[model samples]
Target: MADKRYTTEFFLTAAEVNSQREMPLSRLVTTIIDTATAHANKLGIGFDRMISEGISWVLSRLTIDIAESPSVNRTYRMTTWIENVNRLFSDRNFEMTDAETGRIVIRAHSTWMAVNMSTRRPGDLTPIWKGFDMVDGAPSGIDNGGKLLPLSGSDFEMSYRFAVSDIDVNRHVTTRRYIDLITDLWPLETYDSMRISRFEVAFKHEARYGETATASRMAHAESPETATAQIAVADTPCCIARLHFSER
Candidate 1:
């Protein structure tokens, strides 16, 4: 039973966005991660168990396809589940929808590896799989196409002053918080109608609480019918965010 499913709801706040009053893409992704983690905890398959058993899950890759953006005050629902666990890694799937219309706004595919806590490196997943059961068939028909925004050029520029709340147990701004900042730059309407089909971000430098950091984006691709964004920091690039939109 390594696979589990979950759902959650939360408010979209201004502090979660930039001047355009939209929820940052980074924040949205963070919420999804947290919600999924909480769901696993509720089912007794939490992170604590994984770590204590000499194994922990690490997000090796993530691909988010956004079809629509959630606006402030709007109620949104998120559903997540484990697709499958292999000898070395596991695949997780996520779906986001507008609570009101039930229209899917986002979808994601993430690859995870179980690591040995003592060794601080990847470990075999066989022991981890023995504790869990397959929920059902694997996630089918998910489009694995698209790319994140290039973290370069002058088309976009911004930054954030990390607050006390931004710090995690690791003493650095968490990965999800960074994703929130990037998503916040898109327009509400654009966010609502677009679905992120691919989102891949990696952590390099760590930003401490109360420290200021700038964010920048490059136009990887744009058109009246579709758009993609690439986000980064000053000189050092952090992640690439690709957003696929639906025409209004």
Candidate 2:
């Protein structure tokens, strides 16, 4: 039987770094996502298999906590595994550690479901999943942060028109694009002084190319260092997120 957990070692590059030369939170997400895909493929439950069955995987919820982010030119090893599985969803967790120091840099948890493309509804996982060899370990620190509340108000909004480049194989806006839009809310100074400690997002709807959308952010009153944000198209929210920051 194949190993239940998967690990990948890679070096951070300029393309994956932010203005401060550290891994951007979005890239941290992309790293885990890529590793997850590779693992799923190895387990025979990946995009290729699902698409052949007229379905594809969709992210339901995500939570990430960063202790320290690897800077450009650093090598890191990331491990990911299935934390749990059910007919409707798969729970995944990830931990990234500095390859040289063996220090944990980040931890993340995510939920995903196979969805019928035509109907945009969840498809039964039993037929395809075939069960997992659940890793013998703990999951990420943060839980799969569930559905976030609607934004109370927009301190300010950034407008976007999904373009040809924003579309993916599904012919709709990709989750990465949503991350880009949300991450764009803060200025470079924000990144210089503060780092995202915990980040959570819920993917709610599908937005296609050529659609106009609004990205809004509001500071949380209870947690002055945190912010809640959303991306809505035609007043219909497609993605909502909460971000907690800590001084660097």
- TM-score of every model versus the real structure: 0.70, 0.94
Best by lDDT, which number?
Answer: 2
- Tell me how candidate 1 scores on lDDT: 0.65
Query: What TM-score, to 2 decimals, does candidate 1 have?
Result: 0.70
TM-score of 2: 0.94
Model 2 ranges off by over 4 Å: 131-137
In candidate 2, residue 61 scores what lDDT?
Answer: 88
Whole-model lDDT values for every prediction: 0.65, 0.86
lDDT of 1 by residue, 32-67 (tens): 678767866876657887877888766656777766
CA deviation > 4 Å runs, candidate 1: 1-4, 11-21, 145-166, 180-216, 221-238, 243-248
What is the per-residue lDDT of model 2 for residues 126-226, given as tens digits with 9 covering 90 to 100? 76755555444566776566569989697879999999998997698977799989989988798889888889998899999899999999998888898
- Whole-model lDDT, model 2: 0.86
